[model samples]
Target: MAAIDHFWAVIPAGGAGTRLWPLSRSSVPKFLHDLTGGGRTLLQDTRDRLAPLAEDRFVVVTGRPHREAVLGQLPEVAPDLVLAEPAPRDSMAAIGLAAALLERRDPDDAVMGSFPADHVIPDPHGFGEAVRTAVEVARDDWLVTIGIEPTFPSSAFGYVHLGEPVDGHPAARHVQEFVEKPSVAVATDYVATGRYRWNAGMFVVRPTVLLDLLARWHPAFAADLRAIAAAPERLDELWAGLPKIALDHAIAEPAAAAGRVASVPSAFHWEDVGDFDALATLLTGAGSVTVLGDDDLVRPVDASGLVVPAAGRVIAVVGLDDVVVVDTPDALLVTTRARAQDVKQVVEGLKQSGRADLT
Candidate 1:
């Protein structure tokens, strides 16, 4: 294995994962759930997958409420590496905090790889190689984002327009533009063109380079983050004033507009697992899920493309195809696989109706 002395990983493990409601709650985020084939929690799998590349230099940036959960899942991670955010301030602040913290350790041209904890990458080896490639590209002082070849017209994900190929690395292309999540038809057009890739939301860049870009592009945010890092005790004060902006909106898109962003085509299979349908796809193709009980036995009876996660609970699905039946102790969710994206609306309705238990 190649030594990754200059490489570090920053995992953002916040977010309630409302899409996976009933099962994923504020107490248990998506990263803590077992939504992968290997049975490892998403956070653990993410850390372990990058172990060969990042070695011991990985930081988990999570909200203060989830500190214990993050630590419990990754006991091997040092206590200092588990940086806790006083509140949720979105990805820009998270990455800024990580860069600020990492700058304190290795200020010199250190490469930091940022990833969300809930994403699933099926091929670890391929993922690591892609990271290595990104690291090399980052050495040139350009922000590098991993772009997944779109297998389908996915409206759930954002897209990156690929410009001309880089002079040296043919696999990586200059980023022409970053498009927000598009409509199904627009996504289909993007897929048909074959010039666009799904934005994986994973990035690699040198700490100094990121700090420089943030300072240049968002000076106020950069100052606030630095102050927050310096005064760790007053994080609450810092977070109170930070804006809720994602890295894509705050950094990547701006950099791309400035012709400073590039992308590497990812070889590994990646899934954001943003909702139940995504999770169902990851949990399928393996062991059969069985829910115990006489009155509520939910098995995949003569049905394909179904997910029954009511383990040990009573669930019975008599005639269902391409359906997701998730039974929780408090609530039950039965929806067609195609309608899984609307699960968030259900959560919203539950919240509006003040049904905390259902959520």
Candidate 2:
């Protein structure tokens, strides 16, 4: 695909991924790892996927601690483009700051797309097509999000309620509303209606328009972001006072209500890799043992799950099904796939017990 003109890819790469503990520590988050056993890290893969469209136009917003690591992984992106926050203020501040910077840097023609650095999009071509469509729609002064076509009733993701199609762009639909994650039964009903798509939080909008929409609801917050962008040094001083909120709550949801949001329905598969179970599903199928590291280090008698031998120690599983065993040098995790989401509790317990190093 050819590079999209005036498109700046904004990457938000600041999450601890507490559910994927031990391997995904605060010092080195999950986005910095190759959880899928792929050659490149998740952050690298994300940059590669956006490179075709961004064409060297990139802005990576990450925490101060991981700034050097992000730069190390994405050496192609200019050092100045990698904005590091002095403190964690959530997605709104991260992406909003990027918007403010781009609005100032390319005020006349900057159109920015916000994509999380941790997501795994296997089909970059389809993703690009969706992004291209989003850029076209965004040029008409509407906030655009690439909505994933849900393959199943997934209770884990939020849903984008689709309304009528845009007048000229039939593939792009007006976003009626954004719904929170629903129960399985409710998700099934949503899928049955065929009027919903998974909200992947992929947004494309003109930098000026994004800040203006933000200004409508959060005047001071928007002003602070632009002020930091203008004076660069005030980032730490104003950043602390910014409301720590997700972009969806801070802008997208309200924008949809005001009839200013549109969505491009996409068929590509998207995976957040939120936990070990998701990682196992992405790596291998059911009824088999999948090793992320050296296969020789894992021996399974009747195991059907994931085993990561990161410590190079021999791990033997016998008569176990749907189990997750991640062996790190400092910590080892053994649990069932059914309880993968609960792994965060273990990290919490370790932190409360003064075992922060293990987490």
Candidate 3:
């Protein structure tokens, strides 16, 4: 497949990644760490995965504090294209701002694809093909999302309700609605229906169409984004006034309700690596303890879990299964896979105790 002309890859790289504490911090979020021990950070890997489809057409929207770090990770993306938000707004503002800027630069027929910087896709070829189909569908003015074919009934991610077959695109379908994360039992039922897909938050659309859809639900928000795009100098003054809302609630869901959304069912294996459990699943080998860093520094006896020896200290796990141990210079996290989500509570405790530096 060839590069889609005027297609800009917009990356939203702002997240606390609290559950992945010690290794992932607000100062240097998960996207900046090589959680897979794959040499490149998640942000850099995202750039690599998107490079073929987006070539040099890229825009990264991140928080002001992480702007320089995002540049350090992605030297290929032009500095001018890295937009920094003065404050932390949700996905709607981060992605919508990029769309608005592209809407101004390319104006008439430019397409922008928004992907989160922290997610991992092991199958780039399949991902590119899915993106290509999505871009083609987006060219017809439909807000297209790359919906991953469900490998299992996962309660971690939202589901895309697949409707009728789209007229022109081969694998595309009209998206009936976007379902929130369901209970495991409900998710099991959703997977039983072949029409459901994991909503990967991968969207491809013409910038104008995106902003216009946003304008319908949030007129002032859309206007503010456009105004900031028109006068980049005004972002500081105007950004504070914009409502902090997610793009899903503000546009995608409503668009689906209006019969304006389409989905491309994708086979590419994707993972958000939301917590230690996800990271363990991605890196762990069958019947073995997975060490993300310096395997020699880790010693396990009848243990099957994830161990990160980031502190360069020897870590010994004895008779443990499904455990998570992450050691950094300043902090260490010890927990079980069943309670991985509780790590965020540790972060909150640190913040309240005025030890936020350890968080």
* Number of backbone-clashing residue pairs for each candidate, in the order shown: 3, 0, 0
TM-score of 2: 0.98
Q: Rate the local accuracy (lDDT) of all candidates.
A: 0.82, 0.94, 0.92
| Residues 64-138, model 2: lDDT tens digits | 999999999999999999999999999999999999999989998889999999989899999999999999999
Candidate 3 ranges with C-alpha deviation above 4 Å: none
Highest-lDDT candidate: 2
Q: Model 3 reaches what TM-score against the true structure?
A: 0.98
304: Cα error in model 2, Å = 1.5
CA lDDT of 44 in candidate 1?
95
Which stretches of model 1 miss by more than 4 angstroms? 286-305
lDDT tens per residue, model 1, 7-99: 999998888888887667777877898766466888999998988888888989998888998899998889888988877889999988998
Better of 1 and 2 by TM-score: 2
Per-candidate RMSD vs. true structure?
2.6, 1.2, 1.1
In model 3, pairs of residues that clash are none
1 or 3, which is superior by TM-score? 3
